[model samples]
Target: MLSNTDIAELLARQAERESGILSRAFRRAARSAFLWPEEVANVIAQNRSLTELRAIGPFIERQIRHWIDKPPHSTHRAPTIRRDFVSLAKARQLLARKPAWAKILRGDLQMHTRWSDGSGTIAEMADAATDRSYEYIAITDHSKGLKIAGGIDEQALKKQGNEIGKLNAFLRKSGRNLLVLRSVEMNLNRRGEGDMSPESLLALDLVLGSFHSSLRIVEDQTNRYLAALRNPHIQILGHPRGRIYNFRIGLSADWPRVFAEATSLNKAMEVDCYPDRQDLNIDLLKIAREHGTHISLGTDAHHPWQLEFIELGLAAALKAKLPADRIVNFMPIGELKSWVREVRGRAPRRP
Candidate 1:
């Protein structure tokens, strides 16, 4: 029977062979397949409308229905760019086998808000986190360096901190079990240097440094990874590989060395759970697990509902057999705060 992964591969191939609107339609469906919550075959077996799935329209639905009715053989493996991604449906299945693993998550470490490109307000994001019963969540909007994403500057970061302080106070007042941590996804230059001032970053509860430029280079980025890990201000490397499915393959690096460096510094590497950017995919995660490196799970969510994407990271970690103690998200709120503070304490102070 054709699974969503098989269907996605077929759609990607069709998109490659065709052109214009039809091609784009297939490409969109291929990407959307990752987020589809159920197998297309199973949906058909239950007589559900294919349109219920994202990016599926009547034309594409008819084609998918045909494939479902007559399962195809010899479906080729997904190419390098689209490889190794776990569909949401599959992640859900993997997580179900060990329900306790998901329950251990204390909070989401990476999310955006109106301070940057995210559509939701601080209060709106809080409401959603409250619903999930998250003990804490980091507001990691982009730094000023990444103008493309409406990144916030130091002044704006200060203002955002005020808003977060107010929100945390309100939550405490209302007896809500949520804490919105002040954080930023600080952009790093090629030298593993951050765009934000070190003094400004000091105020943040956590810092996630990421590369937003020069990502297409096929060279070994081992030194770059080392520098980022050694960066005193950065406690977590966000979306370490910078891979985006079907778009960029991301930078190449010596896996063991990079993970080892992160381990030595007591820094974490994030499994960005946004469907398209599941960087530090299972293959790399296996190496990270081998090195005893810390793991952080972030939905990289732009909106409230997108928080559910964290399950993808959870399943990936479980599959990688990462020790629960090594996952920062699994820590209690106080322990999590203590870890961040310790990471900061270890940093060499700027003159």
Candidate 2:
């Protein structure tokens, strides 16, 4: 039987062989394969219409059914850009085998709201987190540097904080356990420098710095990783590789040295769980494990529903055999805050 992974590969290869709108449809279906909650084969077995799946229409569905009816004799391993991504169905299977691993997770470390380009409001995101029993969730909206994403300025950051404060107060009064953290997905230059002001970042519960430019560089970026970790304002390096599925290959770095620097500095590296951008994937997480580096799981959620993406990152950490204590999301809210404080304390004092 062809797994979703197999089906996805076939679709991607089919895309390469086609042209125009047909090729775009195949490519889209391939990417959506990761988010499909059930295997296409299983959906077929249930006598359900394949159109129920995201990005699948009659044509794409028929193509996928043909592949399911006749499994390929041999499917080549995916290229680097498409490799190592865990489908939601596969991630769910992994977590099902080890239910306790996911139970330990207390919160999500990154998300966006209407303060930036996200579709949901802060309250909506909070309500969704509450549904998931999350104790906290960070609102890491884009900073002013990423103007393309409706990034917020420092004044806007403060105003967003005010709304968060009111929401937290209401949650407290209503006896909800959830806390919305004030944060920004600060854009980083190729030199691994952040775009937001130090004063602006100081008000946040935590900060996530990420590279948004020069991601296509073919050079080794060990120094870039080092510089980002050394950045006093950032506690987590978001999507360290800046890779996207079937798109950019992202930057390269001396893995061991990067993990070691992050470890020594008490900084955390993120497993960005966006379906198309599961950066710091299982392979790198294993290297980080060897160094006992801190691992943070963030859905990079743009909408409330995307919170479910956490499973992909959670399963990756479990496969990597990362120590539970080293994964910050497993920490209770108070302990999670303390870890951020400790990480901040260790940053070099700026002038």
Candidate 3:
């Protein structure tokens, strides 16, 4: 039986053999294979159309059927960009083995709302979190530096805080345990400098710093990661690799040194659970485990339902065998907040 990874590699190889729109569609289908909730073979065995899978249409379905019927010898080696990503089916299987792992998760650390580029409003996201029984969810929308994502300015961030405050009060009065954290995905430059002001960041419950530009540089980025970790404004370094499936391979750096720095600083690096962008994948997470660095999980969700994406990160962490004490999302809301406060306390005093 061909696994999802095999199917993805097969499709990718087939894509290379073709050109134009057909090739793009094959490449997209290959990426979508990682996100497909079920194995294509299972669907086929159940007499279901392969089109039921994402990125699959009648044309792609026919091609997939051919591959399934006559297993193709894969010519493509899994590149760094496409390696070690877990399929939804695989994540479910892993979680099934340790049924309590998913239950221990208290909240999602990174997500967005309409205050930025997200499709859902704050109330909608809160309601969704409530549905998931999440103790809290951070609203880490894009900050002003990333205009392309409709990043929010400091004034808008303050306004967003007011909304979060009101929602928290309402939830409290209603006896719901869910809390919405005021946070922003602050854009960081290559120099490890943030785009937003310190005063503005200080007002939020937590801040996530990520690199939004210059991601394609081939040189080692050890100094950049070191500087970002030392930069006091961020408690979590979001998506440290900046990689995207089949699109960008992400940056290179001496990861052990970077992980060690994060460990010494008591900071966390993220496992962004966007299917196509599962940064801090299992390979790197293993290195982090050796360094005893803290791992944070975020769906990088733009809408509420996307919160389910957390499973990918959870599975990645489980596969990495990271210590429960070191995974921040495993903490309850109060403890999670305290961890943030502790990290913030260690941040250098701003001039």
Candidate 4:
């Protein structure tokens, strides 16, 4: 139960951490603006902050990080719209050719091969993503909770780590830039906690928290996520909500508070690439953006082809008007490593 004053205090402390451009513009815009989108837009367009604007304009709330008017689907012709000042068609064309294995950054990258769900072995997944240019791939296997899906418990996890070591050795023999990260996809259980215990979670390179069940309880949903964040071992909260099509979670809890807590603790939230279960809806995403929360866009990828969700996520992020740097996917390898280390305090990672 966070008080309004608490929220204000937290926000104020964070304001100091904001960049100079943001601080000035927001201050200027906060004053004298009426509640009008056009006026708000005018202030931003003219480089004025709400505090220094002509009027305290209408507080424009974004349901997403930004808005996206996607190109209409075209069968015979290419689709087009404007995204970040670039013609949508041009961006799409540029991306359409990127190898499916391609990733935005390199290093600390690991992927799965045929040994698990996708089409390769530890070494093979690394080679493919490397071919497309990625630095690291976290080879997170399903945990014991997902029995039907080859979930691994302590024994399985240790084995995976050992195997990753071998892969690293093989890669080093040839002087390749790659690292196999040992990780897991944890499930958000009935108790609001994720699948594995905090102690177990701490051992992995990264743990993706997801709501595999108990998603209907909308009232306590945000609290559930907050509790998960309190656990230092959980590095990334995956698909905060468990909303699958035809069965949406119907937006629950105080997202502002949730994002605030996560950002304060330096935890990462997921922007799952699974369209079928677009759990953390646009509105929540907007909250993350406004709160300056760090977001991780995952494909919730069950197969190799699913990794392509990165491009699709770009469309969503563009629509939200979110800055690319705000996303973990767009982060450089070192920054990504640093943030993960900060959250888990587990580093000098094993070779």
TM-scores of all models?
0.99, 0.98, 0.97, 0.64
**Model 3 spans with C-alpha error above 4 angstroms:** none
Q: Give the worst 10-residue stretch by lDDT in candidate 1.
A: 68-77
lDDT tens string, model 1, 1-351?
Answer: 887888888899889999999999999999999999988888888989999999999999999988877777767788899999999999999999999999999999999998899999989988999899899999999999999999999999999999999999999999999999999999999899998988889999999999999999998999999999999999999999999989999999998999998998899999999998998899999999999999999999999999999999999999999999999999998898899999989899767
**Ranking of all predicted structures according to lDDT, beginning with the best and ending with the worst:** 1, 2, 3, 4
Better of 1 and 3 by TM-score: 1
lDDT of 3 by residue, 35-65 (tens): 8888888999999988888899899999889
Clashes of 1: 0
Alpha-carbon runs more than 4 Å astray in model 1: none
Q: Mark the regions of model 2 whose C-alpha exceeds 4 Å error after superposition.
A: none
lDDT of 2 by residue, 259-311 (tens): 99999998999999999999889999999999999999999999999999999
lDDT of 2: 0.93
Better model by TM-score: candidate 3 vs candidate 4: 3
lDDT of each: 0.93, 0.93, 0.91, 0.55
RMSD of each: 0.8, 0.9, 1.3, 16.9
